[model samples]
Target: MTEVVHYALVIAHAIESLPLSRAKRQLLSKITDLDIAGRINGFGGCIAKNKTLGEEVGLAETTV
Candidate 1:
């Protein structure tokens, strides 16, 4: 449970760091739909890849 919350905060912190426009922010904010448990389950599946994607675009670690 604590791990879930930890990753959620990490995710939320990551989302908050994005350099997004209002339209982009709307899309990013939808990430809230993917909560702590969701992240714990899905983190290894795609989250790591997501970090790589952000890197490709010059985004920082927390930007994803």
Candidate 2:
């Protein structure tokens, strides 16, 4: 589960670094967020609830 979250974060960071349009970036971001949230929930945790991207990433990193 931790590895899954880490992988999702890595993918999210990669997406963020791409020179994409704002709309496309946001679409990818939301998709990544859903993936991460689902992974965390499957792990019997809910760290992503109401958290900002930075906050969620921080939690994911620490958990990993």
Candidate 3:
């Protein structure tokens, strides 16, 4: 449950960090959807990967 919330925040932050452009918005939505599913299914190391992705996109680091 905590991990789900953490990943949700990371996804939200990633979406918020994107430019306010339609194309980027759509892309972010799709990307986050997939990421969330993958994380929920225990596929990708989503928490760490999302943190890295957020940093790469200039979002501040957040505690999980």
Across 1-64, the per-residue lDDT of candidate 3 in tens digits comes to: 3544334335346676766675456545655776777776766733445466545545544521
lDDT of 1 by residue, 1-64 (tens): 3553334445346666888675456445444544444566755323334465455445555655
Model 1's alpha-carbon lDDT is 0.51
- Per-candidate TM-scores read 0.31, 0.46, 0.43
| Top candidate by lDDT | 3
Q: Which stretches of candidate 2 lie over 4 Å from their true place?
A: 1-12, 43-64
The ten-residue window of minimal lDDT in model 2 covers 55-64
Local accuracy of candidate 2 as per-residue lDDT tens digits, 6-58? 33344427787999876567655765667677665664323444345435344
Which is better, 1 or 3, measured by lDDT? Answer: 3
Looking at model 1, which ten-residue stretch has the lowest summed lDDT?
44-53
Which one wins by lDDT: 1 or 2?
Answer: 2
**Reference-based lDDT, each prediction:** 0.51, 0.54, 0.55
On the 0 to 100 scale, the lDDT of residue 53 in model 2 is 43
Better of 1 and 2 by TM-score: 2
Clashes found in each candidate (C-alpha, N, C closer than 3 A): 0, 0, 0
- In model 2, the Cα lDDT at residue 51 comes to 44
